[model samples]
Target chain A: MSGGVLYRPGDSPVHRIPPQVKLLAAFAAVLGVVATPREAFWAFGIDLFVVLAVWSVAGVPVGWFARRAVIEAPFVLLAVVLPFVSGGPRVDVLGVAVSQDGLLAGWNILAKGTLGVLIALTLAATTQPRDLVLGLQRLRAPAWFVTIATLMLRYVDVIAGELRRTRIARISRGDDPRFLWQAGAVARGAGTLFLRSYERGERVHRAMLARGWAGHMPAGPAAPVGALRWVAGGSPALVIATAWAVAAWPV
Target chain B: MTASVAMHLSDGVLDASTSVLFGAVAVAWLAVAAARGRIDVDDRTAPLAGLLAAFLFAMQLLNFPVLPGVSGHLYGGALAAILLGPWVGALCLSVVVVIQALLFADGGLTALGANMTNMALLGTAVGFAVALAARGLARRSRAGLLAVAFLAGLVSTVAASAGFVVEYAIGGQADVSLGGLAGVVIGVHAVIGIGEGVITALAVGAIVRVRPDLIYLVRTSETRELVAA
Candidate 1:
């Protein structure tokens, strides 16, 4: 659980910027990048430069971001298969004929994914998980969604820790779970966790009722984004706008 | 599942009908939840809900490769519903989808409904029912609960795929056979479901062990307090 990076405290410029701006910028950048066509090599390059710059400004350690970013690389697996799977003209490369469309699809994924991950990483790196949710609500995200997400985040660590212990307990008992036939122990562990989660939810609900929690969750006034922060944050939107316009025009 | 995936807004494809339909559905769900008083408005719950949605959104952005050509993201709709109850869980999941769409453009605005219905509603509702059944059958035994979770998660993933099949039949973009697509979709997803079930059970189990009180899905001792009173 500790291996996964949560919020680490830092005084970088990103830390000082309002979470709302970061939140907004993250969305804008993602949209801009996604809207980019596969052919816009220079557009993707510019996006990469901007994301790296933001990462630096946030003062998030390069190693930490790099490690955390690894979580997203799995989606690249889709790109890998695209060439073989997609129907189109084939090009011979390295003794293998790959679909030209597939290569384009891969580029599309890489570009969109890299930019998407960068935006997400920036948000995750700069803001605490809790603050990020608040920003979503402030940005007009629905209340029910916010609640489930909040609880999930709060409990993810706890649940993950429980899983670790359970695995350890099983191993200590000389259980080797590698064989598919030996999965019962792991399965039983899963059952145990579900009951605990169910019981826990009930308890939490009662506590909520006691505190006058109705169904709909209320909002909080965590500070607002500053003007200068908006300026800095809004800069990406301008860049994206420029790119979008260029992409939109007939070449 | 592909259709359902299409239903949920993704980056490459954008269509007005899908966007409008999805957006409307999202709004409608919120309205319904609000009317049903599912969204708990309080100092503690609201902020936490929003936060959870945000976290889910972020976590989903981090997809892990599950196969040579496939990757998996956090599909926590069922887990969330089991913990928070369907009302809250659905809201939270939809929130995550909406955020992903608007911010990340991960899902399309038009296909939001299809996404919500498949991932949030069908997945969560089906998962909750199965989990509840598991709870009842196990008499609150932890082992029983996990088994239920495994079954529920496994079933729900397929169900989500099924939801897509039905949608595709209705709004078919291609002339492919529904039977063929359904078979392929369900087959692949069933395999994926094992991973989903295991990961979900493990995550939920770990939470139940330490901070069982924090898990919204579990019934608390305080409910007994009310029953005693």
Candidate 2:
């Protein structure tokens, strides 16, 4: 499902880095960004610069990341309204009175939200989905949890396709799922969809049993990554850490 | 249209300490839920949990218009909790939320723990609690069952919404008006909760008709009491 759409095929240094290292680095970078105090705008700037530079190095297009970043729109709305509703010391900007604290909070949300989404998109863009499963297993994630995630990644697209067909069938029957009156049909559709999906699961289990499938999928522990790759791959987190420390020690 | 997963908080909205604190809570409960689900039905848990997670992912994509220009989809917690026990339901929803956050970017990665806590753990627990409380009425008739499901959906949704507010109050960096924020958010969700209730009722009703045994709450109870079936 995610084979073509979310993940892009690339051979950059970022892509070559093991998925486990990249996942840890992305997570740590986000922690650093979030932990950096809201007053430290310059530190946030350096965090953004480091993220963008990596995206460039990984050959991820700015337009691609920007388009996918549309998911953050709702958070942006919340951030924008904060300045208006916030009660604090007033500051006049653009000929309107706005709360200075609210303005800082708004910037905080926007900057950190952008950085978090971009960092995740980079991992998704660089690593294949299957590789992510490997990363999880290597990270000592529970086998059952990884098993569920793997099956979900496998089946989500098929189910979405089924949903598309179901929607089309509704439309063909002169049912517009868009109207509130048609919600009954939509719910029933969801109900039957559940049965279909459940039966599909049952069948899959039966097939596995018939094939003498073991209770678990074969997932071997991956070879350990090297120290140099750890430091190099973790550079994003390192940069944000330095910025955070610089901001912190001054206080 | 908001994916059920969209109920999540965005990154950096909560301070790092709050995020980490909630993260620990999420991981702790998730581990317990996984362990419990595994002990119940050893072999089928994987396929059931996996496909159920997929089912939820697809269900969230089916958004029905709630307003003139607004649409909302099933969070699917009540329905899932009613079908599978809370253990399986929580695990399934957690998987969906993680995938949505990681692969789709529908939710924030950094706030993954917080999202899992509210959307998956709290919602499923609340849903099942309501279902258990109304067990007698639900067993009597289909109408009663639907009503119970509706109530489950409404209360669970409000509970999850309240969760976000609590976290925001504690960890929010900006000194925004908490009262106003809570009102707007809870008020909108109250209306959306009605939609959540109705949709949940209808869906559960359909499942009851086709596969009565699949309803976990109704099943493990006094089988002789299931007059609705």
* TM-score of every candidate's chain A: 0.85, 0.92
- Tens digit per residue, CA lDDT, model 1, B1-229: 2213323534323223443454476577667765454344444445445445534443454343454455555577666776666766777777666544433334433345777788877788788878777677534767766677678778888887787677656643323456766887688778777877775666566656665555555666796345224
Q: For model 1 chain A, where is the 10-residue window of minimal lDDT?
A: A178-187
**RMSD (CA, Å), each prediction:** 7.0, 2.8
Error of 2 at B133 (Å): 1.2
Q: Can you give the TM-score per candidate against the true fold?
A: 0.68, 0.94
| Deviating ranges (above 4 Å) for candidate 2 | A3-5, B1-6, B39-41, B221-229
Q: lDDT for each of the candidates? A: 0.62, 0.83
Best by lDDT: 2
Best by DockQ: 2
Q: Provide all candidates' interface root-mean-square deviations.
A: 7.3, 2.1
Docking class of 2: medium
